[model samples]
Target: MTSGGRIEITGLTKRFGSFVAVDDLTFTVEPGRITGFLGPNGAGKTTTLRMLLGLVSPTSGSATIDGTAYQDLADPLGTVGAALEATNFHPGRSGRDHLRVLATAAGIPIARVDEMLEMTGIPAFARRRAGTYSLGMRQRLALAAALLGDPGVLILDEPANGLDPEGIHWLRGFLRHLSTDQHKTILVSSHLLQEVEQTVDDVVIIANGVLVKQGAMADMRGGGGAVVRTPDPARLSEALAGRGLTATPGSDGELVVGTEDLRLVGEAAHEAGLPVWQLSRKAADLEELFLELTSGTNRNLGPGPTEGVA
Candidate 1:
């Protein structure tokens, strides 16, 4: 089997009239790893994916897979497998027949349809009509269709949407196997940061259609502020200030240090005769980081309570 290739997007912008859906987005997805394309709702993630797949043209810039645009690929399905929507299948077709139709269309062998059904763990339901399948089964069928051509790259949007915990766990391992064992390039998009945090090695975060941050998950999580607790909070605050570290009082009256260096804060407190009660480094979780990055963008407001009610 052929390994995955690099995906590069440079200055990619998309606009619908005066509304900018994607603005100057730039990133590179390397082979042999799963990269998460993440953002809040209305952040242009779907628009960007559509543009990449050549379903929607970008107003400016380029999105390329293996140094060529998706539209220009001689054998697009054989190079990139994508499942942007699980409901894109014909409801009347059986699960196996759905994949068979796609494989036949792609000039793939009919036998490969059963292979994909088994590969995606949906062979037992292969004879079931898609309309009768549950949402989770539909997702599996969509994935099977995407892998029908045995493509090197997999692009999935919210693939875990309807999966149970066990199914989600299975998917995580499955994606990891594709990237690590099969050497496939995988790009999966989801607004649920916690789900993607466990599956992706690197992340490209966007907000309001603009790139907010992009880097390894380890680096992003490690770059968070620490919390320090001392009996003499004021003295510790002063000590941190003396040592060129900023300390602010947390809501619970604990001193929140601005650095991840627990030892540095402890030493400064010891030297200042402030008894250290607790000094723990706080790593930022994906949810916290995501909320911080996209705080003011497209937040939903609940309707006001009924006027003069009760």
Candidate 2:
């Protein structure tokens, strides 16, 4: 666990035939914290990450770990650990066997297999064949395999893809511990907003193969946009507009004040003599912000695919 090393990508572009998968993308993953890689399905997040891991050749630009490409590193496994997909496992191999095989390939110690299994809490089923294991079990095994070399940085793509709620919860805590306590630099990608919200300290948002924004979650959320709920919605809206504050109608006639100062909203309601049903400030949750940034909207219809459900 290394607390902080810099991963810098500059003008990184990848093209598949005429289709540009990634368009001059650039970002950094700081050590000692999780950096989330987010985008819509066609946003090229997976392609960018693959390039970062040396799995794909970029048509232009570059991704570097400590200013060096992953392939150029002497010991690439020691530099980065990755869990790209759950289906990357061999069906005939046992959980422990799978880790052992990768550890051998990486020149890691055989003992690391048991150690990772124990640490990941999958030792009880370590001897179970991988194909027979449930989705949750496969996720754990994949994670264990990634940790085989005890690399300083981790690159994971949709690690929570098939996990149950409890498994997702476990992974969230585990990743945080690896970054905070173990000091591993982690870059994880996922479409699950709630899980990413719980796990990451920073976020890099992308849409339609283009970079949208990237920064600490606190900074983004604190930059003057928050929801303000009130009992007298109509009166509050009028009061806010009078005071030069931007307020919008949220679902069910709730007033959402898109301003920084919570006090301003409160004072306006009080000055207008409106009843304070509720004046609590609400930051857009990760899910809300994700949709807003990716889909460019905040309307939640149902759990179904949309124009760009990435």
Q: Which candidate is the best by lDDT?
A: 1
- Please write out the lDDT profile of model 1 over residues 1-310, one tens digit for every residue: 7589899999998766656778898999999999999987677788888888999889999999999999999989888999988898788999988888888788999999988888889989999889999989899998988887778999998899999998899899999999999899999988879988888999999887888899998887886688888778998888899999999888897887889988889899889988877788778766887889877664223332222100
C-alpha root-mean-square deviation, each candidate: 6.1, 5.4
Q: Judged by lDDT against the true structure, how good is candidate 2?
A: 0.79
RMSD of 2: 5.4
Q: Residues 188-215, candidate 2, lDDT per residue (tens digit)?
A: 8876566687778999988766788899
TM-score of candidate 1 relative to the true fold: 0.86
* Each model's backbone clash number: 0, 2
TM-score to native of every candidate shown: 0.86, 0.85
Query: Where does model 2 exceed 4 Å of error?
Result: 1-4, 222-239, 246-254, 270-277, 285-288, 296-310
